[model samples]
Target: MHKEKQQNIKALFPPRPEEPQESDCCGSGCSPCVFDIYHLQLLEWKKQCSDILCNAGCYSKTSDGETNEPLLSPIKFSPFQLLSVQQHTHNTFLYLFQAVRANSEPDQESAVTEYTYVKRPLGISVGQHLVMRCSSDGNQNTVVTRAYTPISDLRASNVGQFEVLIKLYENGKMSKYIQNMKKNDIVEWRGPCGNFTYMPNSCRHLLMFCAGTGIAPMYPIAKSVTENDLDDTFVHLLFACRCFEDILLRNEMQQLSLYWNFSAEIFLSQVESTAESQTRYGECVKKGRIDKGVVIERLAGKTLQQVSILICGTKSFNKDMINYVKHVGVPDDNIHLF
Candidate 1:
């Protein structure tokens, strides 16, 4: 992920191949010298570069047959209308939106000007995010923005719409704003953020560790890998939530596993397995927290070189999982934090 920042900074402001030698220091008892100034500038450059990426779009051919250009420019946030909203869980809602470009008038050559509204083209990928901007006081300039990854497969059918799964929380600015939105309400959006990319057959097996709503990005990843149908590809997901009710996309995941080599284990920290959960969830449900015993048993004979683990959760979940994996002799390079 940091690679993009480094590349952008170097392209815009090239860094010195090597630091200045002792003889070139030119000491003048200055409080902060040229090197210090350069370091500060580099930090600023990184921030700016990250913002640019947050608003960048994917490379794809547009309606006009142009390639290698963003379908939506990063110069401005595009307007998208809320086509529909559905409650996915107790607190999570799925918002579907259609892109409506400003000044999108029909060509003069066409006699019939059809104004049918369709889903807008996103030109985004599986793991990329969309930055949504809205206002609480109805002030456009003083707006608040939030980043959300689309759980929909945009490239699967090149549809004009996308779906985002958002969880509502008390005192949550963005969530509250989106939840209260009515049908056809226009929301400002921009994107294709994040640097995680999934390629087919990239690894022998993919291990995903996510907790709570952190499963957002993992959904698209597992979907993409399974849809690709690579012969040697396999996926294992260790998802931890508070209880069975908190588990999101359970039906969709189970449906996918019916035809793909995908397996998921749901761990609950607050409840023990009951007869109801056992009958409903079967072997997928487990009590207590994810531990070394679980990890080791699942990864018994799997080759480390061919396995890559993705970690996404709260700060503590990430730290604890990383430490636990390290304790089991897994190399630092095999574990990735998202």
Candidate 2:
């Protein structure tokens, strides 16, 4: 649970690999250095160099035209009305949201990273879901919304934005439409949806299991631990990926070692991933899987009641993990599904 939040923190204050000026990697002015990693991330050339680079992928053999594989497209679209939009990078876009209400809560808030800048929906109470009319490019403009445990921080004054992580799926319909969105494209949306939420004081220790693009929910939960100063508790996170290069917010994860004073100083970790397709689960898990046993070993003698688990991944991966934990005797209540 907390591991999810810590990942969010990483998304917030991502460490830059290099500073433009020859300063210390910690954004310090000190010039002399041993390893200039801070200098590297900032370099377009370093990325081109094969020796020092991190990316998320494998050398997939392009399917022969003769093959019967489903034609895959890497595009997705979920309509969000043109309330507003912000461009963070050439490739990154942030859309301010107007969603539907689910219910009401007295004190609904989320932990946010310094880098997490967003708009809060105006006139909407915390915990109240923002309603929107859901639709695709076609004729069916359905009114339905998924509940999102508000990931926006209270500090942000913009009463319109929420954080969302959308990755292109292979020949995905919604993915394709999102990639095609133009400025001022009016989109209709509804609801801060999802039953998955982090309740405070549920456990002193948390283990979060995640995969590519599954890191979104992990953020708000982890933030609660760090920002609220849950120092007595521990957060163990297992993030698996295809290769070490695919790890997101690599530098930001490093910052979590000493996070907000609450919670036990969070120790953030990731399973340095490898191409799972090339390696069987047994071997890959031993190497790239970020062994759950290792996590248990790290928590030696800790009671399962004292710790809760959160699992998020692809449909197939999630099934396998949930079963493994259940087989290990973890009660159903303690294991939160993502």
Candidate 3:
């Protein structure tokens, strides 16, 4: 009987994770690195073992024989149905996903027979991102995963929905999968994963640099700060794109700019400034790339200690922005990359 008990206890232990090889890392400076994922998995395994010991081999399981999980999790993916899709630009698309209810039942209080569901907020923090996975059509074994930050307002009431903006690359694997998605198609998502934390009024000023769809993470933080009545963080945003039409979230940015504390400037690298373009975008649009001069101008009145820097873009763009900021005396600790 003792020997059987020992075997039962041993069966509850999960296999230990193997450390990732150096070659496994793409070295693009991903937020949750392969090493980071391994560490999180290790911590989860330890907790599971501890729980098993405390419960004396008993474990809780839902009706489907799976552990009851949260709407979003770092360890497991949850299915969300594609409620709608909108094309924002030539290549950018906005997707809205609704959480799939688990074992929903009809409400007896209502005269009509319909399933009533309680909406839950996505619970995404200001600057966090989520990961999505897709499998190739022909080969189910071929899976591609990418990280995206949602642009939905975090302060809004619970709606059981969230939106993500994606730019379809010509030859991107994930882009191909997303482009073919239809309404009601199910997608697997897991997240609210990121290292950066934004506390209300944590800093006097926020200097953000983004290009293309990189504005995803920066938008939420800026929106939260500007909308809050008590938070007085000044936001200075430098957005870069090929042309005025290429700017993602143009209307939303324009709206946010109405706030006294929020200011945004767009850098057009490819297009020549025309009379109509200048008139429409006004003084906020510049006809060049974001260089050291622009960085200096944004940082003119702010002290280094009270300012926080945020950067999100392609590899080269991120490198350039980081170098530009560091050259201007901003310390490494104050800079955050997403």
Candidate 4:
């Protein structure tokens, strides 16, 4: 069965205009089962953590067999197995979470009050995924979940805990849930899910592209390049948004440009009015709609191979940007969606 638009777009919920009205016929009654939503969320989590190094199973259950002996099973899985299960589990969890939310409108003051850890954490590496479970809110009611790359060099710092900077989505399900979390509350989280891992050695000229919260993974990739002294790489990032307010991590991302090899540019195409009829940020933000053609013009003449484009945002935003890239001749393989 196909999932509804609402359930498929996890982590990034649609705006009011995007959401179907309550009268649209069904929600809790199988229109889009909360189970499906939870699964989506869990799928994302598992995909990233699938690369985690596991020597033991997190859960060991006593099983009865034909032999009737104490059936002790050694746990082992290829990266493929782990990733597949991780992905499936995540999707299931994501869908299920909706049910939890619908059934229980958690108090806005609670953070991660419960905690759970996987059996074994992986030793993350270049092209590896990292998931961080942190307190996302100031209250203690709900657990806010988001994904990020571990910025610390994997070899140098085998940090036990992963860290991801989260920008509170305005009243977002997960964002609002996290913003109100109290200290000591625990949110369950697992490994790196994105196929967007940056290869430090593979490319030199990096054209890192982003729009909004999508900037999270790019930060780690850029940091890895600079901090590890990958000077051969010249970085040019084109971040888009309506106004400066919709922008996130401006100061931090700008600082990355200070690196001798980095060049960063910001375009407010639709800040207030559309210079052209077909615009993206202007209408939506200032007055126009997002035009991938303009965005492509901004990224021409770069080493697409060396350049890793990390696009993260709401589902529509990311999808539109992705389709734009393919339309403009960027090899499907070259674009990395975080």
TM-score top scorer = 3
Minimum summed lDDT over a 10-residue window in model 3 is located at: 53-62
Candidate 1 structure quality by residue, lDDT tens digits, 115-151: 3343335667666778888997799776889888788
Residue 22's lDDT in candidate 3:
74
Each model's lDDT comes to 0.70, 0.46, 0.77, 0.45
Lowest-sum lDDT 10-residue window in model 2 = 51-60
What is the C-alpha lDDT profile of model 4 across 96-215, one tens digit per residue?
000001113444677433232222223444333443344444455544445544433432222123444455556567655544444443444444354454433444566656665555
Candidate 2, after superposition: displacement of residue 67 in Å? 58
What ranges in model 2 sit over 4 Å off? 1-138, 141-151, 156-158, 230-232, 260-287, 295-299
**Superposed model 3: Cα runs more than 4 Å off:** 1-70, 102-118, 138-140, 155-157, 278-283
Clashes of each: 1, 53, 0, 58
lDDT value for model 1: 0.70
Kindly list the per-residue Cα lDDT of model 3 for residues 82-163, writing each as its tens digit. Answer: 8899999999999988767544455667643332232455556667888998896756689898998888864231345688
lDDT (Cα, 0-100) at 33 in candidate 2? 43
Pitting candidate 3 against candidate 4, the one with the higher TM-score is 3
| Candidate 1 ranges with C-alpha deviation above 4 Å | 1-68, 73-75, 103-121, 140-142, 155-157, 277-283
Q: What TM-score quantifies how close candidate 3 is to the native fold?
A: 0.73
Would you estimate the TM-scores of all the predictions? 0.73, 0.53, 0.73, 0.51
Q: Candidate 2, after superposition: displacement of residue 246 in Å?
A: 2.4
